[model samples]
Target: MKRKKVQFGVMLHGPGGHMNAWRSADVPSDASTNFEHYLSVTKRAEAAGFSFVFVADGLYINEKSIPHFLSRFEPLTILAALAPMTSRIGLVGTISTSYSEPFTVARQLASIDKMSGGRAGWNVVTSPLEGSADNFSKDKHPEHSLRYDIAEEHLEVVQGLWDSWEDDAFVRDAGNNQYFDKDKMHELNYEGDFFQVKGPLNIDRSNQGQPIIFQAGASKKGSGFAAKHADAVFTNGGTLKQAKDAYKDMKQKAVEAGRNGDDIKIFPVLSPIVGKTREAVRERYKEIQNLVTVEEALAYLGRYFDHHDFSQYDLDAPFPELGDIGKNSFQSTTDEIKRRAKEDDLTLREVALQETTRETPFMGTYEEVAETIITWIDEGAADGFVLTPHVLGELYDDFLNEVIPILVEKGYYDTAYETDTLRGELGLKFKENRYTQKIRV
Candidate 1:
């Protein structure tokens, strides 16, 4: 894969990503629902030259769900609302293929692309929680592999719908009374196992023709879908070696799927704790960790295991034995937690705290955090990063003010917004309409 400039995306979780973030005095009580708060944060990110702002979504929630997940704006709706407000920043939102119809998802995303001048991205997801099926009025959720099969067909139909109209299809001419070129219009007429969409979409293509496709693929089946379809991958970064292995595997899969290795950029999540000094950073980290109790940590860990009650286990005993509890939901993450707990001989309480406040790779001064980021990208461990503001307002502000400038001086980042579209900012080529390609051939 060819080397490219590192990119950054800010992942927003209203008050913060931490479980006890809402308890902090610095955070607004209604930050998650406050449109003004969102607007302010996005504008700051845009000004700081971040590549995009990502909004994660989940359909079903329970009493045990995290604070941020319990109450948050829907992804597509919020992204659309943010489109006209900001000009250059990309808007990426998560929408599950399991519950949503391709036609509706396609139209909503395409509308955002048009509204943002082609600065839209869709993070394709298969609703992992089994309870999601209940909310959708389905008897049972599709199993892991079956969900990917549906995702494959769902994405194909959506991309097909995007190519409904050719690039020069619209020709508004009052004198000739010609609104659009009829020959350029084409119907998808797609008939798949999961979906059967017909005819051209009502909305025309956007500036980039299609919205960028993003997927978070950790399992075998999930990664295969992303390798073939996604333009970028949002992943979790474990360690330098672990990240490198995943990076290499993803690039190889993309090549085997008949795409350039560089076609699908790999972005692992970067959640750093940055402060003015090492002492200050350690103090802040400890303060944040103390916010979440042992019970809360157990609940947070249970979210990956289909909400399995971890409170029943003895706090001082070894990690419980659950053969395949989390294979369907967040397989990679669950597997890692189990493997690490067993390998390190961690007690139940130890595992809970460690998992809750997982050690951040970048924890120190602002300069040190910047250096770690450069090392990760330069070492082929990552192409870019999905920056998670673990403590919303405070951490995010520090990163944009202190760390980003160091990155700029070191040639790993730039502050100027030269492109209007997300694809251009990420150095990805515009997708040409399939109908237009047929005409040229």
Candidate 2:
């Protein structure tokens, strides 16, 4: 039997996860738009038997987008292209339900599922960005509660569309003069508070039935929505204790919603910077930090605090007091900024220019890093991890080469791919067809 292991995935948001990594010379400045460079990274991840690859997206961008957000490939299109280049590894991409038609979005995701042979996953995002409404011909974005409401219906419609045809719906039989089983087909004549969709989808279910659904929600409504629907939840936890509480809360909420808690995976987001020794880790960490100026870092804060411009405040002063913000923006991140500020008694400058050192969570020698990751899994703080690297090329290679081996030896990581489907690899069940009832009738 394959060893029971801790699941892991690589999160590629632009060139890398760290905003300042784009300024680092080790990363090619145009890596965001460079497909060949991205292909190499994907190949490396696949070669190393990593569980999945993810791409985050946004529809709107302004001056604060840094480099990667300013320009990059659209998530679905790029994921489809990567399909032919690899096998077995999962391909997940982000799409905002708030900005898309369920039918069209369903079609696109179903196509990727077909292309990747059951290795497709969708990160269902509800909000687009700060000014995404104007691009969609609306003067204002939907409020927080309203967007979640739309998202709830949006998921229902999309999954219903995916269920348009049953698993055995298609049959090519020349002798009987038949092409498809009519009785096996289903029509989703669905009308919800937010949308009305009439869908007998144009595509069949891919290898895994439908693409696996992923969510990255930490707010009240967002968390509930994920517990009820998502196969997995991506999150942030600065410490082992925080991760354990988060993991328990999500599982409990899932159980409360009448679902088995194990069906949902909790992947805490971590960006590990490892070294042979603590000194080596801090030195390399400083190099990436020095690349971005204080002014640039403050501008970076604008993405989270959508309601307030931190640049207008005194840098040396305590992180400026702000009212409830990001209700229509990144609510969880905004809450985190406030929480960290109060906890650390930090200045606006310190908050903006956050850096990793020995005292930080995921920065340390190989042994220390491995110990913390294993503890999170054992302590029920995390089911697995969605790792974001500071720099995609060198730093990613370092973790794969150095840190993962340690995890495997300690019995917390797997040495090879145990399953072909993304759902199987992530230990999630295939989504049951909702339209199965319609077809039976």
Candidate 3:
């Protein structure tokens, strides 16, 4: 049999972009709070034959340190609103296991899936930021290991609740005054390490059974959890080799957990800054760079560096010699910068600019970008990509107009969405996957 074509999605962020994405004058700065902006983007994505539009969630903002768009509408609420506006596009949103109750999360997601006619997806995340704990009324954030532990159990409860309502559970016979079939509804009766969720979900099972589970942690515990549960894994891979290795590792882990390795769709976040020519792309990149301030960059860096003050260092300085500052503090960030700097033969200022810009690895003309994406997919580095636009409307419009047709022509992506439900579009086995295997056995 011939292999199936790859898939793709747009990873939407608040206020039109990520980090310094707003610096693009073409992006709407007010998008974080504006429902109309989200509607416009989702409609465009759907029209472009994109797989889905993903929304990331963060509860609090470090106002003094970073200019993040934190006070926007909640992910679930926003997704629900967008569901009514568009019919076929998937709506995936982040919900942290650290703070939310499984029942609440399960119910809300199920409701959205139903309301949207089964186009909802839940991106499960155990928030890494310690500051989020404060907003949730906790004195301190749990350690990383502990958070994953809770996440494992939290996922079990949520999945169980979703399964509580079987396909035939809702009959709604008006003549008999019967709304549901009691025998088909199963009480979850789940008692786990972190939570005790009892009985069936209040809502009926969604069109896709349970909404697709999206996960994005690359830590050991995270990978393990994703292997066991995630329908799609969102990742950040800087190189084709790195992405391939990560995808291989994730599939191996999934097999060990007794799930089909191919079931886990790997999507790496690709931030592409495209233009008609290389110089035009470079110029556009430079224009965004000019908007970044030293203070803003340092504030963004401070979150990972813990004890260090980036403001004290020269803006154009190379890697600082931190003598025994503890490898735990920003080690990954520092190492990545060092590696990229050497690989690209970049100056310290260039490295700084790259960090602030957070451009997608694939940056060039439409044809070049399309070829690069196809190369990654062919290499088994990704099943698809989660595109993060550097500029909001313009960036998306450019890619949709320029790159999408190329992908469709190359037989790498869909010319049109094949299914209405988000889960169906992603090719996920909605009803008979690993979650139902245990019962079948």
What C-alpha lDDT values do all the predictions have? 0.88, 0.83, 0.78
lDDT of 3 at 236: 79
All candidates: TM-score: 0.98, 0.96, 0.91
Candidate 2 clashing pairs? 244-381
For model 1, what is the error of residue 278's alpha carbon versus the real structure, in angstroms, after optimal superposition? Answer: 1.1
lDDT of 2 by residue, 292-328 (tens): 7887787777777662577789999998878866657
Report the lDDT tens digits of candidate 3 across residue range 1-441. Answer: 444576777866755554655545666676677788788888888888778899987665656433446457788888988888888888999999999999999899988999999888889988766667888889987877788899999988888888886677678899999998776777878877789878677887777878999998776777888999999999877878889999999999999999999889999888788889999999978776677776776666555554246667766756555553423433445555656767766654555556767666688999999999888887889988887775676768898889988888888777587877877888887764333456679
Instruction: Encode model 1's per-residue lDDT on 1-441: one tens digit a residue.
Output: 533467889887787778878777767867787788888888998998888999988887899988767888998878889998999999999999999999999899999999999999999999889999999889998999999999999999999999888888889997999999998888898988878889688898888779999999788888999899999998889888888999999999999999999899899998888999999999888988997999999999999999999999999999988899999888878988999999999998998898767787878899999999889988898889988866777878999899999988888888887688898888888898886777679
Score residue 165 of candidate 2 by CA lDDT: 90
After the best TM-score superposition of candidate 3, give how far the Cα of residue 117 lies from its true spot, in angstroms: 1.2
Best by lDDT: 1
Distance from true position, residue 255, model 3, in Å?
1.2
TM-score of 2: 0.96
Error of 2 at 356 (Å): 9.4
Task: Score residue 381 of candidate 2 by CA lDDT.
Answer: 83
